[model samples]
Target: MSQLCNVLIVEADSKNVETTVPLLRKMNSKVSYVKQGLNVVTHLQKKGFDLVLLADKLPDEDGFRVLRRIREKAELKNIPVLMMLSEDESKKAAFESGASDYIVKPYMPYELVARVTPYISLVLDRQKFTDECQRKDKIAKQLDEAFTEMEIMSRLDPLTRVYNRRAFLEKITDEQIRSRRSQKKFTLLLANIIKCRHYNERHGYECGDFIIKKTAELIHGSLRERDLTARWSGDKFMILLPETESDGLEIIQTKINKVFQESSFEFKGMNHRIDLSFSSKVCTGNDDLDLVLKEIE
Candidate 1:
């Protein structure tokens, strides 16, 4: 009742069909006998068989042609195909036509059963494996996206979408690992607002918040794709630059100071000047992220 052993047999000779039918039935298979290749497709669509057995030579078409048609039909492409080849069959043609398995004529029922059973089981197993693989791939992709989102939420500065303190440390750890293995350069910056606390006390919390967010924006916008910025904490920030040596850190420090110097934010409809005191340490020979961050701090 489960219909698991369902099969469609398409042997052109009535004698071959006669010889094969009882074997298939003995194996608990449902069988259909066809003597012409022309009818295979229609029968294939109607029966929706799990397996197909064919004689290489046919009245209307060859086994290869039927195989081609089977492949062309999207619904039948995955159905397993077995062909009965002659003693001098074309090995190349049979293989190229996508014949799943081949048996020479004058074959024994026990031998036929032996080869065909594994192939059927293989097709079923492959289908099951392929289905499971696709399902897992889809699930893995979804989970990767979700994990990235959660990481962004947890470790990014909200206003500027830069890495925050936790993210900064994680990135630093990654850089340190990379540097230890290779001769690569890494850099870090410890920056603090000169009078950000004063800005809060005198101008109110809202004004202070605007000042912090504005400073964060300038730093975030200045970074290249390879660079990372983080909200180190309130009134503090850290930056990590990969492939930047000691010389590069100097240029980067100058850039940071210049950006802060030229940029001004308004509080209570009045322009408020901001100042940043920042330090940079580049990972060169014998430099560690923790040590470099401490130097900048």
Candidate 2:
């Protein structure tokens, strides 16, 4: 109430209603009144309130029943419900029934104001902090998702869904550092389509693009999970086999060759077997990546 707050005041009698409503209004709170238990439930369902000043008695139902119902609701259960204790009502019973705070009353205005004010302020502050955290979490999740998508688009070839040339170059640099630290070697294999231009001329660029994409898929599927493959150029591809030696390279080459022999590109009615030429080099940790790539050229 000292800070801004919304409070629901449930009072049945005319005298108590008059006293309680004005007392809450003087504190500059957004106050709502419900003279019955059902109306209390209705107002709470339809709106958000920081605090509820529930009278100990309602015309239609016991105030404790209303309090229990509010507590049962998932959404409304957290709002601080202060019970207005009459002379006959037991404060212990009210507390046991989940009353957040209680005030004994023959309408002592100052005591009423003092008791209700702090609870309203505290609940509002807690709600404000909760809302702010939820907003920040949503924004963080959106940012994380956006960054993930941007990273994928940057690192991968859009057409073939393979690692792009730039991504490959960056990875090889990291691999070079790792190899140097470990004193282990890795192999680089570059493969080029022999007559990709002729295939494009014979069919269309779309057909040639299909061939490229399918070849990339085959090469990627042929390798171990640890091996990295990239689309180096329009008609060229490269592979990095980590912690590999000459024997490993030879074995990988045989697998790829077998895959190539079994694979064929079919357009319309004609089937064409694409030919690939491969060159490989073993890096001893210090070989310049640019110079090493030049060997395959």
Candidate 3:
């Protein structure tokens, strides 16, 4: 690796320490030595190391226990552990305890360099890939949320918080197609406000806006959950009642008319009762949406 390698040595033998530190330093590694297996866990926790060169024998405990402890921790688990064995017999035990590799001593300096370099480079590459994947996933989630909000905004009237004219066109077109396929009928009801222009001229545009919002709330409250409501244009609202017959259209119109008559609007210390003129027609599953809207208008 191009970076400086940090190595923790868990050997107390003075001859091993004298021989190993100089060999690793020649390759520009930062080496820390500890004599006991007990100190290994604490040093690993407080510092970041690239690899551990653990002796088969320690002053307090065996190297196998230390290796198991390192593997058990999530943060330290991926770091490569190379056990230093005095005999050829302990190779199997080293591999079983999750040691990445091992060395037989007394060993050559060049062999130590060869064994340790690949593990350090492999770890750095794996970490880079994992970080990149996480970053891309986060950006994907943010983009999905932004698109959802934009879709909702496009369908709604900004002032009244109800479906806009574009939404009405889309809904009517879809309903017309469904009616033709299933031979099911639906009703379209239009509620036109009386004297809206005169009311806006007398009170102010803000009061006119208040009336539109209140009209939407009243219409929404009187309709079934399955029904769709939209603002067709200035001072006009439309409702699409799916699977409803011609006889049911009058029942809906009467209910909305009654509610609008009963409701009152207050502006600048004046109280005013509103009026609505209702018109409704049942689709025969054959009419174009433009022709339907034109006939009602």
Candidate 4:
């Protein structure tokens, strides 16, 4: 690799270290030597090495510990691990622990080279596969996050955090379509917050803003989660209550009136009880949502 032919070689025996170091060095490879498996994890994270050469048995810990740690890490898991196994059982355990390849102890110089070459190739292939999968997963996650953000943005008023006009309309359209498909009843409640205009005239613009925000909160808290509510304009609010009948609409309207009737606005000691007058219509056709809204208005 153009970046760095990095390898972490953990060998407790000095003779194997001496024999392997020179030949590995001659290949223009950078090597990290350690006799303990305990230090393997720290070195792998700190150094960002590409290959890990771990002896199956170390002074303090066995080779499987390092392999397990590497597999656990999302970043380091894909790095090639060339394990030194002494027996068939050791080899099986290393393979089970997700080692790419393993060579037995008392390994020859040429045998090490042969095994090392194929192991590196295997690591490169696995790394490529991993990178591709990550790239796709990241893209999918980004798309999902983006869609969620857009959906949230559409549903909420930018300043007031209430449902925006667009979101309100979209929900109305959805309810209309469903009502048409199922012939289920629905209602559209159009509200005129009359106090907003009075506040705008008597007080400064800030007072009007405060009034709108308070009105939004009062109504939002009064509604069910399934209810679609939005601010249509400075003084107008819209609610699309799906699967609702005339009785349900009247009941909801009564609840809304009670909620606003009990609440008081005391911002900056400017005490006022805002009145939000609402009018609604039971939907008969789905395709004529705009027409129904117009009739409600």
Give a tens-digit lDDT track for model 1, residues 119-218.
5566557667777898899999999999999877887777657777877787888887787778787877777888888878887888888888887888
Instruction: Give all TM-scores, in the order shown.
Output: 0.49, 0.64, 0.68, 0.59
lDDT, candidate 2, 99-136, per-residue tens: 98898878589988889878866766876788889889
**TM-score ranking from best candidate downward:** 3, 2, 4, 1
Q: Write the number of the candidate with greater TM-score, choosing between 2 and 3.
A: 3
What candidate 4 gets wrong by more than 4 Å, as runs, is 1-136, 180-184, 201-203, 286-290
Clash numbers, per candidate: 1, 0, 0, 0
For model 3, residues 1-297, the per-residue Cα lDDT tens digits are 244668888997879989999877776578899999986877998988888999989878889899999998999998889999888799999999989999998888878888877875665566567777877888898998989988998999987778999988888888888998999999898988788887799988888887888888999999999899898889999999988987788788888888987889788888877788877778867987677888887
lDDT score for candidate 1 against the true structure: 0.79
Between candidates 1 and 4, the lDDT winner: 4
Clash-forming residue pairs, model 2 = none
Worst 10 residues of 4 by lDDT: 1-10
In what order do the candidates fall by lDDT, top score first?
A: 2, 3, 4, 1
For model 2, what is the error of residue 56's alpha carbon versus the real structure, in angstroms, after optimal superposition?
2.9
Candidates 1 and 4 compared by TM-score, better number: 4
The window of 10 residues in a row where model 3 has the poorest summed lDDT is: 119-128
Top candidate (TM-score): 3
TM-score of 4: 0.59
